[model samples]
Target: MKHKKYQITCPYCDSPALFRPASMVHGSSVLEKGRYLYICSRWPACDSYVAAHKKGKRPMGTLANKELRHKRMLAHRALEELQQSMHMEKWAVYLWLQGHLHLNEEQAHIGLFSEQMCEQVISLCRQLIRTSTGTTA
Candidate 1:
C-alpha cells in the first residue's frame, strides 16, 4: 500500500473519520488499486472524505463533501489550464493565484478552497488564458 491511514474529522458533520480502502468509498472497481481513504464515520449521510498522502499517514487536505470535492477538481483543472496556456510553471501559477486571489501560500492550495474561492480562481484563470492567447472574446 502506498499510504497509511490516520484519524481525521469531517468538517460537514463533525464526525470522526475512519481509515478505509479506496474501494470502500469508490466501490469495488478500485479494489485492486493501492489507495486509502479517510472517510466520515457518518458517511452516506454526511458524505465527506479525503485521500491519504502516498508517502505518509497524512491526509491530502481537510475532509470535504462531494460538492466541495467537485469544486476543488474544477479549480485544479483551471490552474492546470493556466499553467499550460500561460506557459507558467506549477509554482509560478500558484504564486500567481496567491497574488490574484489574495491568498497566502498555505491558503492558496486548491484542496483548501471554498466554492467561492474556487470560482474566483477559475475566473482568474480564464482571464489569464484569454490575455495570453490574445482572444478577449
Candidate 2:
C-alpha cells in the first residue's frame, strides 16, 4: 500500500506550509544543510517551520515558531534526563508519557505537541525525576 504524504501547516498563522529542501528554505542561510522541512510560504514574516525526517518527506512535527521550538527543545531535554535517570528505553518512556497524556500511539509525539503540551511534559518529567530520586519539592 502507498502511504500518503504528511500535511504540515503553520500553527501560528494557520497557513499552508510547503515541504522543500532546507537549501531553498531561507535563501542561503546556515540551517543544517541538506536537510528538508515544511516552511511557511510567507517565510521570514510567518517564521514557522517543521523539520522533515532526514531521508524522507515526512514531517517530524507540526510547524513551529521560535517560542514553540524552544519549548519543544526544553521538553525533549527533560524527557532525556528522565529517561537516563530511570534507565528506561526511549520507547518505554514515550509509552508512559503517552498514557499520562491520554494520547494514542500514533498521536503521542513530543514533536507534534503544542507549546502548552510541551510545558506540561517538561513539568511532568521534572516531577518524575524528583519522585524517582526520592527528592521532595
Candidate 3:
C-alpha cells in the first residue's frame, strides 16, 4: 500500500515542510497509544518530526444505524486479517493502515483494538457504526 504524504508548514519557521514516513514507537500504555514518526524533507536543515494523533467518534451519536455497521464489520475483519498475517498488535497495524485508507482522525480512532490502534480502529469503527446506523462515517 502507498502511504499518504502530508504537507505542513513549520509553526516556527513557516517553511514548506514535507512529511515522510519514518517509524513507529510503542505506546506508553494500553490506553496511551503509539505514534507515527514523520521526518521532515528538509532533514538536518529543518529537523522536523511530527506524530499523528488518534481520533474517534462515539458509537451512540451519529453511528447508531445499520449500514454503517456492515461497513465497519468489513473493515474490522480486513484489519484483523492484516494483523494476524503480520503477527503484530491490532492497534498499531490499524494506525499504520488508516493512512492508506484516507480516514480522518475520528474515523481512524474507532478501528483500534488498543490505544496504539485507536486511530485506525476509530476510523473503521465509525464506518461500522455508520453502516449499522444507515449513515456515513
Candidate 4:
C-alpha cells in the first residue's frame, strides 16, 4: 500500500521531523483521524516523539487532549508495572541460575542480567499475560 509523508517538529527537541509510512495494520489506521506518530530523525539519541495531528486534518480545537493525556498516563503506568514485574522476574531468574543451575562465579557473572535481554523476556511475558488476561501490559 502507498503511504504519505509529512514534515513535523519533534515535540521534545523542536527539531525538524519526518513521518514515513512504516506499516499498515488490519484493525485501524495508526495515522487515522485525530492520531499521528512522528519519529525524530535523530533517533537513539534524541528519542523524541509527537502524538498529534495536523491542523485542519482533524476537528479544530476539538481534539480530546485530556483523553490523550489520560491514555498517556495509563500507558506510563502500564510500562512502570511491566518494568517492576520484569525486574522481579529477572532477580528470580538470576537466583535460579546461580542456585539451581549451579553456575560458577565466573559463569554467574557472565550470565548477569542485561537490561536489553530482560526487556525482551519482559516483552514475551507481556504477550503471554495479555493472551491469558485479555488486557494490555
Candidate 5:
C-alpha cells in the first residue's frame, strides 16, 4: 500500500507539530496509543495529539483534543461490539461502516471521525447489532 503522509496540526492552536513516541511526548513510559504519537510542538500550551499506527510513523488520524479522543474511543468500542455481534471480519465491518456512513474507504476510520460521526457510529452499531442478533443491543 502507498502510505500517504499526514500533515497533522493542532485542531485548537494550529501550531507546528512533531511525530514521536507517546512516552517522549508525555515525559513518561505511557503506552496508551502504541509507541508512536504526534504532539504539538507547542504542547503543554496546545495539548493536541494523535496516535500513530503500531508499525509505522503514519498517524492513525487527525490530531484531536481530549473530547474528540473520548468520542473516538466510544465509537471504536461500539464498532468492535458490532463486529463481534455480527460475526463479521474486520475488513467486512469496515466496508459496511463506509457504505452506511457514505465515506470512501480511505475516510472510513473512526480515528478520523468527528464527534457527530462518532455518535452516528455508536447508533448505527447498535442498530446493526440488534437486527443481527435479534435482540436489543
Candidate 6:
C-alpha cells in the first residue's frame, strides 16, 4: 500500500509514538483491523494509540485515548444513520458536513475529529435527522 509518512506524537501525553505490533499492544492480533498500532510510550498509563496501515508503517490518524475513541465511534454511527435514512451516498453526507461544520475534506473524517468535534457532529446529525423525519431524535 502507498502510505503517507507521519510524525505522530501522543495527543494526550507528550510521549513518543512508537510503532508496535498488534500483538504487543492488544496482546493478540486476532480480529484486529491493522497489523500494528502507534502506541504511546506511556502505554497503560496514557492509554493512547492509533491504528496503522497493514504494513505497520503509517499511522491512520492522530492518537486517541479511550474516551475520544468512544466519541469517534458515536460520531461514526450518527453519520452512518444520517446517510442511510437520507438515501444519500457516502460522499454526499460528507459534503453536508463540509458545509455545516465548515470542515475541509481532510478534516471532515470522524476518525480525525477531536472529542469536541465529535460531540458537535453528533448533535448536528441528530438535528438533521429530526428535521428531515419530523420526529424527535
What is the TM-score of each predicted model, taking all chains together?
A: 0.87, 0.85, 0.32, 0.26, 0.84, 0.86
The whole-model C-alpha lDDT of candidate 2 against the native structure comes to 0.86
- Cα lDDT tens digits for candidate 2, 14-91: 788987877775566666677888999888799889888876577898888989989999999999999999999999
Better of 1 and 2 by TM-score: 1
Residue 133, candidate 4: C-alpha displacement in angstroms: 25
Per-residue lDDT of model 6, residues 1-137, tens digit only: 56656678897879988887877767774786448888999998899998887763767778999999899899999999999988989999999999998989988888788999999999999998889899656
Residue-level lDDT of model 4, residues 10-49, one tens digit each, is 5446666555322211125654544544546665366544
Distance (Å) between predicted and true CA of 26, model 4? 16
TM-score of 4: 0.26
Supply candidate 5's per-residue lDDT for 115: 92
Full-model lDDT for every candidate: 0.84, 0.86, 0.46, 0.43, 0.84, 0.86
Off by over 4 Å in 1: 1-6, 30-32, 135-137
Q: Give the candidate number with the greatest lDDT.
A: 6
Q: What is the Cα-based TM-score of model 6?
A: 0.86
Candidate 3 lDDT at 51 equals 41
Question: Which ranges of candidate 2 are over 4 A from the true structure?
Answer: 1-5, 24-31, 135-137
Q: Report model 3's TM-score to 2 decimal places.
A: 0.32
Point out where model 5 deviates above 4 Å.
1-6, 25-27, 30-34, 135-137
Instruction: Give model 4's clash tally.
Output: 0
Candidate 3: residue 115 lDDT (0-100): 33
Model 4 residue 53 lDDT score: 41
Better-scoring candidate (lDDT), 3 or 4 = 3
Best by TM-score: 1
Between candidates 4 and 6, name the one with more favorable TM-score.
6
